[model samples]
Target: MKIFDTLNTFMLEKVKPLAFRFENQPHIVAIKNGFIVLLPFLIIGSFMMILLIPPYPEDTTSGFGQAWLALAKELSEPLWRVFQMSFNAISLFACASISFYLAKEYKITPLHTAVLSMMAFLLLCMPYQNSSADITYFGGKGLFVAIFIAFYVTELKRFILRCNLSIKMPKEIPVAVAQSFNTLIPILAVLLTIYPFALLIEHYFQASVPVVFEQFLAPVVQASDSLYTLLILTALIHLLWFFGINGALIFIQLWTPFLLVNLGENLKAFQAGEPLPFVITNGFWDFYVTHGGSGGLISLCILLVLFSKSKLCKNIGRVGIVPVCFSIAEPIIYGLPILLNPIFLVPLLLAPLVNGALAYFAHSLELVPAMVILVPWTTPAPIGAYIASGGSVSAAVLSVLLIILDALIYYPFFRLYDKICQEKEANGKEITQ
Candidate 1:
């Protein structure tokens, strides 16, 4: 009880304010919004990836699976093309999207700013010789570079505007030409500042900007993939949620780059028929650890709907059932008013932690393939599991298993909470609103 009191004090006095500021910070906001704009493109690429390797096993006897595999083989070239253009160009899209949103946030010209960001990104990451350079940096590997470029361009533009650093054409010059002159300073600034670093890195280290960044950050990336890291992240997000903060979205900002890079690596290995190089990815977090939303709220909704005796409890469950199926947690969190609710706290922290451990070990032991495809988080967990696993029956079954386990974890907690609701209802305190 004393520990809870101490924690409650610390959360309210310390972590809560920091979480709110982080959730609302402009750069972080831009990052979240930027990713939203590109979700459809990633989904399309992942769909193509799944088609490249038929979900059915290589030894499958299913007639439909065999026919599909044949068709996939026939269209392999086209499939690879689409996948390469979209998913493989993740960092490029990320640079553009983040810069565009950040520019808008600062009341600048978003379209032109986004283009400038890409221009700088390419100058550093691309090889000098036209045909010799592989596009290794254009994908998830270049993500950090893309982020830096996005910030650099937008902030540079902001500084130029602040210092009145544009080339002003005479009044008689064409309006379009005058607008074009505005971009000259940023372009030159890019060449003068970032271009030198790119050249130096190449000349001395024989590496591109993205490569150096990836190498510098490599150890951190590898560490983030472990079960311990996953559990800590899971706990942090759920803990914040218990106090009425948007912990999931907040953590997503920090985790997205790592998740995207891992997903890219896995995609490459899967395409080459090599072992998947990662155990952590968007699919792992979305479908396995946080299925039905963070903290396994989907499991709680099922318990509320099927078993609660309280009318208010059952109705709340009915309302939340659909959203949680799609991996949204708002309906249950707000409806059940789980925020600051002591009875629900233990299950809130424990369920997803259990799920994360299960998923990490399951994939580690090779009971199922590590996820290659990056399915949308909103996809129902069971369906996302099968698709993300490239049709692994065991992975699909594992998803169901996790959800059941989550429900079992919540069963006693939900029963205790529901009894209170039942008693309150008898006293005409039926928990409405």
Candidate 2:
């Protein structure tokens, strides 16, 4: 046991510095910086205007006729198809760029390396006319592996830098201060670049998970007709988000098959000449629309209100408001200091669970409708929430209520964050001005 312990400690000491160096290396630094610069374009181009996709009609005959409605269909169809291709291409480019930068670190030719990367990306985007299921599975897995490899290659360069480099401090500078700055800059740059891309990739691919999650939740949703079950599901989702796991992954793992089962049931009911209790009144509109799921606007509003004091945090909060309302909270989560802040840990977990519970109750009581429509997650808060719930005004109202609840939850943590910022500002003023 003593020998084992000694070896473990020895290994940790060796690995720690290597890990730190890998995170701070130059090629990694360049890729990270580039990723940050490209993130906004990638996110906006991919997610924006999704709500505009038209929904299918209730009647098959009407839908068929609408498809043939030449002038109107021609106008929208080409534009929508263009937007879809453009967004997908942009995502491919972003991932490809990361791969190229990483390849440069290995003394490999960056420009030439991109050919392989782009080929990998093309494979992901290409249509498999014969088998969509097989295509989706293989394409998604391949893309993920490719991206991971790119990151690994970049980190390897950083490792090389750490081995060959050493910093020298100026005579006038304090050794501790110089050392700290040397240690911090590279790591910060890499983090700023890679983390945001991670968030974007996770979010973009998340679209497919719900089809699975809804399936898993169906039997549970149908079992007792008890609102509590929905609350449980909502809480489970919140818990998953808290740990920094992709919330969509949790939903997909638990529910996609069940959702398929429900979908099959709905089709069977339709074939039996019975009116389905809920028809997917509009697939495009419904699938694309999303807002914080059961958590609603409350989660974002709370974060915004709490972070209002710091110039940076306030700016992030304000900028994030529109996205958060629509259920896209990546900006707020990453931009604010919430990632490591102890103060935020509580509300971040609790607020969503509470909001999810309330939403479940309201939905179960028929005060709000179930989300029968698919809509983009980037739709503004109450509006997206309202539309997803089949255009129910009550669901919009509930969304508003949840926003208020979120504000309440975020209040205390925001105060703590504000206090820290204020202290830092005061210290800066004293030192510089």
Candidate 3:
């Protein structure tokens, strides 16, 4: 208890403040909002991709699967194009959104800044080789570079504005017109700066901007393949939640690019009928590690409804059960008030790691294949697992097994908390009597 008390003090007094600061940082805030804005497109794209894929892995172009493949192609080909158009253009959208949001924070001309920044990004990606645009860089492969340009272009615009390089119009002119003119110099400056550098790299190094930048980010992307790294990140996420912070916002930055790259690779390999190349990905996190929402809130909610003696726990859990089935856990987090609650602290922090470790080992042993499809986070656990692993019953079974184990891990702590709550209620009743 003393150790728990000390740790709690450290978390509240030190960790909480740091988490809040990170959450409030300008760039972090922009990235978080930008990702939120991009999520609908990614979700739509993932759905379309799933539609294009045959549910059974054994289904191929020949034999009994032929008719199914033809039907799938007919239904999903056009939609697949739609998916490609959106998901492959993530870098373009990421640059625009990040610039737009960051510019908003800076009290600048957001639309103009966004456009300018996007233009800067295009300039960096210049000199397309093929008759059709070389779109490889427009996808997840180019996200790191997109982030760089978003900040660089916006900052350059800020610098230009600060230096009074932008046009200053007469006081009587319309504010809109004045603002438009004011953006001109900044836009030109961004283009001039980025275009030449891009040209120089192309001429001298014989590599595109994205190619050059990808090398720099390769290490960061490679780190996610490590189980220890994944576990640490998993732990950090629930730790933040325990302190009442939205962990997803902070950790998604670490998860998104690596997951995106792995998903892209998996999609390519799956199309070629090759085995998946990576075991860890965003899909693994979604469908395996943190299934039933962060910290196994699904298990906690079930226990609350079925076993809790407290009226408050039972009511919250009963209402929360359906949401938890779909991997939504905010109701339990706040309604049952897991955040900042000492009884929940250990289980909340430990549950994700326990789940992640078992899942990682299962994957390492090839007991379950790497998930190719990026299933929606809200999908039910077994169904999501089945789809994500591309029709693996073993994977779905693993999901159920994990839930049971998570429930076990959480049960004792919940019982203890429930007992304490019951005692408090009894004391109150005695006093009233």
Q: Against the true structure, whose TM-score is highest? A: 1
TM-score of each: 0.94, 0.43, 0.90
How do the residues 98-174 of candidate 2 rate in per-residue lDDT, one tens digit apiece? 76766665654454445444544344333345664233322112333334434643453355346744356787998
Using TM-score as the yardstick, the better of models 1 and 3 is 1
Point out the worst 10-residue segment of candidate 1 by lDDT.
126-135
Error of 1 at 292 (Å): 0.8
Ten-residue region with minimum lDDT total, candidate 3: 424-433
Candidate order by decreasing lDDT: 1, 3, 2
In model 2, which regions exceed 4 Å deviation? 1-237, 260-307, 429-433
Candidate 2 worst ten-residue window by lDDT = 280-289
